[model samples]
Target: MKNKLLLLMCILVFTTGCKKDFLVQEPLASFSDQDFWTSEASVRAFAMGYYKERFPGFGVNDVGGVFSIRETLNDDYASVSLPGFPSQPTVSGGGWATYFSDIRKDNIFVDRVSGMGMKLGDSATYKHWVGIARFFRAMDYCDFVFDYGDVPYYNRPLTDYDTALFRPRDPATFVLDKVLEDYTYAAQNVKLDDPGTGPRGLVITRDVVDAFMSRQLLYAGTKLKYDPATSAADRVKAGVYLQAAKDAAARLISSGRYAVADNYQKLCSTIDIGATPAVNKEMILYRRYNTGEVTHAIASGNNVNTIQGNGAPKDLVDAYLCTNGMPIKTTAGVNPAYLGDQTAANQLANRDPRLTNTFRTDRFYLQYIETGYSVTGYKCYKFLDEPTQNEAYAVQSFNITDAPIIRFGEVLLNYIEAAAELADMGTYTVVQSDLDKTINVLRKRAGYTAASRLPDMKIIGNLPAVGATVYDDADRDPSVPSLIWEIRRERRLELVYEGFRENDLKRWRKINYYNTQLYPKKNLGAWITKSSVTKALILADINGNVTSPSNTATGSGYLKVSQTFRNATSGFVVDRNYLLCVPTYQIDFYGRNGSTLTQNPGW
Candidate 1:
C-alpha cells in the first residue's frame, strides 16, 4: 500500500498580478468530487461506504461486538453495560449524531444518485445501485423513527444553502411514510437476483429489504395503534400498515427462497453463520467475517473464563414449551416435573430443546472454567464459543462467525403479529392457511414434528383461529390484549438473544415489565442450592455464594440478585423512555425561527 497527499493552494497576491493568480492542481489518487458521480462504477463505489458503516454482520473488525447480540438493553437476559451502562440513559442524555450522521450519508447518496443529471439507468438497466441507496435511506429513517420518535426528515443533499436542515422535526407518521416509500422502491427495483455485498455477496437483496420493512412496518403500526401519539383518525389506519407488514412477509414466503433451517441451535453456533448461510436460509441478511481480516470477540466473550455469566433467567427459560408442544409450567405433567426436579439438570431436561440449546444445563456446566461468567447463575449457551476460536491457543477476539441482521423467522413472527392485530381491529381475518406457512413451519423446524408446538394452530382446524382461543392469564397485564400477548410471547421465544426484546417492550408500550410492581424486582436470578452435585463447575463459585446458608438453598446453589445490573438504572421511566431523545444538534439546527426538532414526549 502507498500513501499520497495533494494540497491545492490558491494564493491571491495583493499586488498588481492578483487578477491572474489561481490554483490549477490535479488530485493525486483521489476522485474529483465534480466528476465522481458521472459514472455508474463511481456511484456504486459511494454506496459501498454506507454498508461499511451501517450494515451489521459479524464484527467487521471488532470481535464479540457483532450487531445482533445487542440483548444487553433488552429484558430477556440481563448483562452489565459498561463503557455504556446496561440500562437506559438519563432523560437529558442523548446518543449523539453518529447515528444521525450515518443517516445523513444515506440522504446525500440518495439525492445524488437520483439527481445526477441522468436517469439512474436505462430501461434495460434496473438501477441496482440506486435501489441499494434507497434501501439504506429507508433503514436510516427506520432507526431514527424507533430511537427518537419524530425526527427532521431529509431528502435533498446537505449544502451551505440548505434551509430545511434548520426546519422543525417532521411527524413520526410522515417520516414512516417516507421510509415505506424508500423500502417499496428498493423492493421493486433492487435486482432480486443481482446478488449483494461481502465476500459471498450474500448480505443485502430485494427480499432482505422486504423482511426489514416487515419488521419496521409491524413496529410502526403497533406503536401507532397502542401509543397515544396518533389521533383517533390516524389510529383507524393502524390495520393498513399492519396488513402491509403481513404482505411484505407474505411476498417473502411465497417466493419460497427463505425458510427456517431444521436445526435452530446451529444457526448461530460452531458451524459459523458465514460457512452455513446457505444451510441457514432463515437469515435473509447477515454480516460476514473473515478469519484474520475481519474478526470479532464474540468468541472471547463466550469463553468460560472471560464469559460474564450472562445467563438466561428463569423467567425466559420457562417460556419455552415442552417437547409435547405445551407450555412447560402450564400443564400438570411437565410443570410438576420442573418444580419437583431437585437438580437444575433434571429440570432443564423436561423443557424445550431450545431452552437447553440456549443455556448451559447440568452436564454441560462441567466444562465451565473456574472463573465464573454466568452472573445470573444460569449461564447463556446461546451463541456458543465456536470450536475454531475456543481453543487454548486461539485468540478469543478473533472468532469469525457471521452475525444476523434480518432473518426469515423474524418475518414470520412479524406476519402473525400483524395479522392478529389486524383481525382485532376488524381490518382482516387471519385464517389457518396463514399459520401453515408461518408459525407451523417454525414449530416443525424446532423438532416438534411429533407434536404441534402451538396447539392453537393445530386445534383450530375448522374454528375461527383468531377469536377461538382466549389467553386468560391472570398474571398478564390487563392493558395487553390476550391475542397480542400470545403473539408477543412467540416472538420473545423465537428471537431471544438476537436482540428483539427491548424494542418489543417499547412498541407494545409495556414499560411496566420493568415496573417492580408487576415483576419480581430487578436483578433476580435462578434458584440454586448448596451440597447439590449438579456439575463439576458448580464447585467453582458454588461455595462462595453460599454466604447466607442459614437463609436457605433450593437447587444447585442460590439465586443472587445482580448488583451490576441493579446500579445501572434508576428506572426505565415510562412514556419518556419509550423513545430516545433527539440528537441535540438536530434540535439546535432545526430549532431556528420557532422550529424545534422536538424532544420526544416527556424528555
Candidate 2:
C-alpha cells in the first residue's frame, strides 16, 4: 500500500496478464479483466497508475527524482567521481525488451478501453480514457525514439507466441508522426477539468496534455532541425512540428487556466503546493506526497549534513544573468551589476534572484570553503525546506515534499523558446508583446520589482537586446544566432537542475559541450581562497594528477576538483553519441525472426 490509488490502478497492469485459465479460477480478491473494465472508477484508477509509472515524484524514499539532483552527464555539474562520456560502444543488452514490456502495458490499456464502448457510461468519458492511454503510449514511444534513432512501433500488444514484436525498426520521422497523432487526439479529447477519485492535480487534463505536447514537440522540432542527418523534406516537417509546438504552448497561455503565481522556491519544496489557490495556480500536474503514504527523502540530499559530491559547476552558475538582464560576459563593456566571483557572497550579489533561490546563499550553509559538504561549493537547496533540515523526518527517507511534474513556469519558457525558434526559421516573428507575455512574465514572477524588472527582450538588428541595447556574449557558439543564444540562456537558467540540460544539449546537436578541452570551465567550480578553508582542499591538474593551488598566486582561484584529461580527446563521439545503440541481442533476435533490425548509424 505504497499509494492506495497508484497501487489500485497498477492492478490492471500486473493482474491482466495472467493465464486465461487463471482468470477462470479467479479468487474473491482477484480482479479479472472483465471485472476491472466495467466501472468508471476502475478506468480512472488504471490511468492513475501511469502517473506514478512515468512521473515518480521525487522518487520513492532516498532516491532522487527528476528535479532534486544533477547526477546526469551534462554541462551543469562537475565531479571527479562521475564517469566521463562514452568513447566507444559496447553490447549494452536488454533495453528494448524492458521498454517494450512497459509499452505493451499501455497498449493493453488502449485496446481494452477502446473496446469498452458504452460500458464506462458516456462517449466523452470513453474517449477521455482512450486519450489517456494514447497519451502515455505516445510518450513512451517518444522516449524510445530519443534513445534509439529508429524504434519498432507497436500499436497493439502482441501475444507471447506472436513474432510480430520482433519487427524491424520504424523510421524516426514515422514514429514521431504517430506520436503527433496521439498527442493531437489527447489534447483534443481529454477533459479540461477532470475531478477523479484523488486530489485536484493528479489526473491528466487537456492542459497537462498540451503542456507535455509543447515540450515533446519542441524537442522533436529542434532535434530534427539541427541533426545533420535529417533530410530536406524532414527539415520542412521540423518547421511544421515547431509551429505545432508554438501553438500547443499558445493554447495554454491563451486559456489562462494556469499562471506563474506561486513562490518560486516553495513550488518545488513544499509538501502540498495544491493546498492554496495562489500557490497551485502555477502547478499544472504535481504528485502529492503524503507524510505516511508516499513520502521521499529528496530534502535530505539537500540538507546540511549531506555532501553533494556532484555540485553545480561554474558553467551553469555563469549562465544566470545579472539583475539588469544583461550577461556577465557581454562584448558591450562590463555589466556593473556583476560583482565578480572571488567569493560566494560577491558572486551571489546583483545576480538573478533564481541564482540565490537555486543555491545556498546563506553564509552559515555556504559550503564553498568546506569541501566535504559540496565538491563545487555551489550547493543547491532549491528543493530543501530550511525549517525541516534538522527535523527527524528530514534525516530519514520520508521527507514529504511534492514534486512539480508540469507547471506554468516551464510552459512559459517552452512557449518563448518555440516562438523564438520559429522566428529564427523565418516562419514567425517574435515581437515585444510575445516577450512581455512570456519571458518577461517569468522574470516578474522571479521576484523582480517593478522598477528593477528586466527590460523586455527584443530582436534588434538580428541581435538579442535588452530594450534597445544589444549585447553580445563572447562565449556564444558562432553558428547559433544571437537571439537563439539568449533564448537558450533563459531556458538553461529557468530549468537548471530540473533534469533538462542533458536533453537540451542533445536536441541542439551540442553534446560536444561536455568536452572539457573545448570548455575547461565545465570542470571548474566556485572561486575561493585557500586560507579560508580549514579542511584539506584537493584539486587535480590538467593531467588529472593530484596537485595543489599555485603557491605564487596566494591560493586564490577556482576550486578545480576534477580534471577530465582523457575526455579532452575522446569525449562525446559526434558520430554516435546523440542516438544510443540498440542492444546487440535485440538485433540478433530480429535477425533470428527473419526481420532486419538495423543498428543506428555509427553505433
Candidate 3:
C-alpha cells in the first residue's frame, strides 16, 4: 500500500512539472504582486532591495563605478586611455539601467500594497512605506535626468503591454516635474522622526525626505536647461525652490539631530565602521553594509602597497586646507605637503585632519604579513573596511563599510552655497555668514587649534608662490567675495575623495575651466613625479648590512638614465564635446519604433 501511494504521488508531481519549473527558474525573474508584498516583512524586504541596488558595495565592485566616476573630475586618478587629456567618460548604462529596474520593482511594490488591503500595521506605517518607495523613485529619476538629460517617467506598474514596453523619452523639464512631484509626495507623507522606532539609518525618515527634496530643488534651480520655459518668473521659481532647500536644511540643523564628528580621522575610519552608529546626527541617509556584505575596500583598494594602484590623485591631496583654513597651495609651494618625499607624518602635519583619515598618504601603513605595507600617493581611506572582517576576502578584498548617501553636512553646504548664489543675485547678502557657520563647524570637529580664527592675509603675506596663477584673483586678499571662491575651495578640500567633484564642476559650468589641456599638463608633472620611486636598498651580505642604489626604472620598467617621465597632453580645448555622449549602445537598443534619442554634441 505504501509503494502504491508513493508511485501515485510521483506521477502527480511529474504531471505538474514541479521539479522542472523549480530547477529551470530564470535568475532575473521576479514574482507577481499577488505573490509578493502581502506582508510587512515582504515590504521591508522590498525596501532592502532598493537600498541594495543603490549602494551595491562598500568598496570597488559595482558600487565603485558610481563613486570613481564622480572623483574623476578633480584628480584622484587620470584616465589611462586618455593619458593627460581630460575627457568626460560616460558611466556605462548599467548603473542607470539597474536604477530603473529597481524603480520598476518599487513601483510594483507600491501598487501591490495599495491593492492587497494587507494590514501594514498602521496608517503611518503604510504611508511611510509609500513615501520611502517614492523617495527612491525620485532619486533614481534624478540620476537619470542628471546624466542622460531626459528619460521616460514611470510611476506605477505597466498595464498596457504595447505602450508600457515602448515609452519614449519625456522632455527634460517634464522629467524634473515628475521628480519634484514624487519628492513632494514623499516629504508630505513621511515623518521627520521614525514612528516604528526602527534604527535611524534603516528606513527612510522625514529628514531623509527633506534632504532629498533639498537636493532636487537645488539641482532644478541650478541646471539652466531644466529651468521653466516661461518668462522671467521662471527664474523666480528657481530661486524659490532653492530657498525652500535652504529652509529644509536649516530646520534639520536646528533640530540638533546631527553633529560633526569630533576627530576628522575618526569620522572616516571609526564612524564609517565603528560599533554603535558613528555620529548618526550628521548622517541624514546612509546605506548600512553589514559585517559580511558590502565594503569600500573593493571600490578603492587598500592594497596600495602591493600591485594594486588605487591611490587618490594629487589634485585631491592638494585640495586640503592648511591649519588656517587655506588651501595647501596657499602655503606649500606647488610641491604640496602630501606628495613625493614628504613623509606621511610630515605631509599630514597641520593639514585638515580629515585628509589623513580619508586617504592613505605615503605615511599611513596597513599591517602586512610580517612587515607593514606603505605606498606613495594617498589611497582613499573613507568607506574602507578594516581587514579583520570576514568580508575581507583574499581575492575580492571588499571592505564592508556603510556608505553615506545623504548627510546633514552636505545639506548644510548645499544651503550655504544656494544662499550664497542667491545673495549674489541680490536675493540676500548673508552668504558669508552662512558659509562661515558650516566651515567653522567642520574645522572645529577636525580638532585643529586654528579653527577658532580665520586666516589673516597679512600674517601669511602673499599666497604661496606655486600654482597661485590658477586662482584668478591671486593678488586679492583671501577675504571679500573672492572668499566665495575659497568656499568652493573648501568644499573641494572638505569633501575630497567623497565623490562630489565631477557633479560640482558640471553644475558650476566649470568643466571647461578644469577640463582644458593646460591644467592637466601642469598637474601631470606632480602626479608622475610623486608616483616614481627615488631609491632602493638591496641585501649586500649575510650580515644585516645592505647596499643602496638610485633606481631610475620608469613605470614601464624601461631604464630612465636621463629622461623624466612625461605624460602626453591633448592640445585641443574643451568645447561642447566636454559633455558625455549618451552611450551609443543605448541609443541603438532603444531607437526602434521612433524612439530616436539625441546624443550630446561633439561626441
TM-score sort, best first: 2, 1, 3
Off by over 4 Å in 3: 1-32, 57-74, 78-96, 116-118, 164-167, 193-197, 225-237, 271-278, 290-300, 303-314, 328-348, 359-398, 431-433, 450-483, 513-516, 521-596
Per-residue lDDT value at 173 in model 1: 81
Q: Pick the candidate with the highest TM-score.
A: 2
Q: Judge candidate 2 at residue 18 and give its lDDT.
A: 64
**Which regions of candidate 1 deviate over 4 angstroms?**
1-19, 23-30, 60-69, 79-96, 116-121, 124-126, 195-201, 270-278, 331-341, 363-370, 392-394, 446-456, 459-475, 531-558, 563-569, 583-594
**Model 2, residue 472: C-alpha shift (Å):** 1.2
lDDT by residue for model 1 (419-445), tens: 888887877776777777777677767
Q: lDDT of all the models against the reference?
A: 0.61, 0.77, 0.54
Which consecutive 10 residues in model 1 have the weakest lDDT in total?
1-10
lDDT at position 432, candidate 1: 72
